[model samples]
Target: MTYTRVCPLAEIPQDGALAVEIDDTPVALVRSGEGVFALSDICSHAEVSLSEGEVYDGTIECWLHGSCFDLASGKPTNPPATQPVATYKVKVEDGDVYVSLGSDE
Candidate 1:
């Protein structure tokens, strides 16, 4: 699979996320526990961007509804959100963040 360069690793702070559009898809780049993750930027329960939410315990909580989603699986761990988001594959290369439209898990 081709790993496309997205952003610099320093752009995303620890326990923070950034929204990026690739191929017209908004992907959420999350930095949790010294790791980088990519997921669907839209909240499953709302049209809001997950990047606006806060990150804690490896999950991103929707700022609109307070719903939390797993960074690794994109699964909802809280109410008000039952639908699962799509998580992309992410890799860090020499301080740069690379993501794949394929798989990270």
Candidate 2:
């Protein structure tokens, strides 16, 4: 799949999330442990940005309604958000982070 470079790997804090945009589509680039993940920046249950939420244990929680989504699956792990968000494939190369927005699988 084609991948677009997002940002330097160092830009993302460990266990934190960064808000980015690709082709006008908002995306959240999350760093958890040694792996980096990408997801729709918008929360499934709310019109809020998920990148403004908390990151923990491979999940990102929605700040508006306490909805937590799995970083890898984009599936909500709690209430107030039964719908799952979209997840994208991510890769790190040469200290840079690249994401494939077209690869939601």
Candidate 3:
């Protein structure tokens, strides 16, 4: 798997999220607790930006329809969103965040 540096660790607030484009792919970088997660920025139910939503308890709620998605699995934990978004591997090194879009496996 190839990891690409997306942004600095400080760019995303604690328990918050950020939208970044890597290799022409829109990804949502979420910070929950002390871990960082990467998922598709587009909401599976509404095609809205997930980064604009609120993050709580390792889940990100879609601001448009209130659909909440799990940051770790990219699966919708709430209604209005039955499909799961794509999740990528994330790593933090030297205060920088990196993401790998190899496989969900």
Candidate 4:
């Protein structure tokens, strides 16, 4: 998977998320606790933006349905969401956030 620059690392809060549009697809970049993750912006339970949700405890809770997803794998950790969102590989270089849009992690 080829990595593409998403945004500056500082743009994402220590425990929050940011969304970037790549190839017409919205991708959510989350900084949950100590780890950074990349996942699809849409929530699995409903048509809501995951980037607008809250992130904590290594998970991102969808604001629409209140489903918590593992930031690392984009897998649902709670109810209201049985399907998992797609995840992508992310890497940090210097102070920039890079993502591989074609590959799911």
The candidates, ranked best first by TM-score, are 3, 2, 1, 4
Candidate number of the best lDDT: 3
| Stretches > 4 Å off in candidate 3 | none
- Ranked by lDDT, the better of candidates 2 and 3 is 3
Candidate 4 lDDT tens digits, 14-91: 899998888888999998766789999999899699999989888899998899999888899999999999998889
What lDDT does model 4 reach? Answer: 0.89
lDDT of 3: 0.94
RMSD of each: 1.6, 1.3, 1.1, 1.6
**For each candidate, what is the lDDT?**
0.92, 0.93, 0.94, 0.89
RMSD of 3: 1.1
Q: Please estimate how well model 1 matches the true structure, expressed as its whole-model Cα lDDT.
A: 0.92
Give the per-residue lDDT of model 3 (tens digit) for 27-82.
99999998899999999999999999999988999999999999999999989999
Ranking of all predicted structures according to lDDT, beginning with the best and ending with the worst:
3, 2, 1, 4
- Regions more than 4 Å wrong, model 2: none
- Model 2: how far is 22 from its true place, Å? 0.2
What's the CA error at residue 12 for candidate 1, in Å? 0.8
Could you tell which candidate, 2 or 4, scores higher by lDDT? 2
Backbone clash count for every predicted candidate, in the order shown: 0, 0, 0, 0
- Stretches of candidate 1 exceeding 4 Å from the true structure: 103-105
Candidate 3 — worst ten consecutive residues by lDDT sum? 96-105
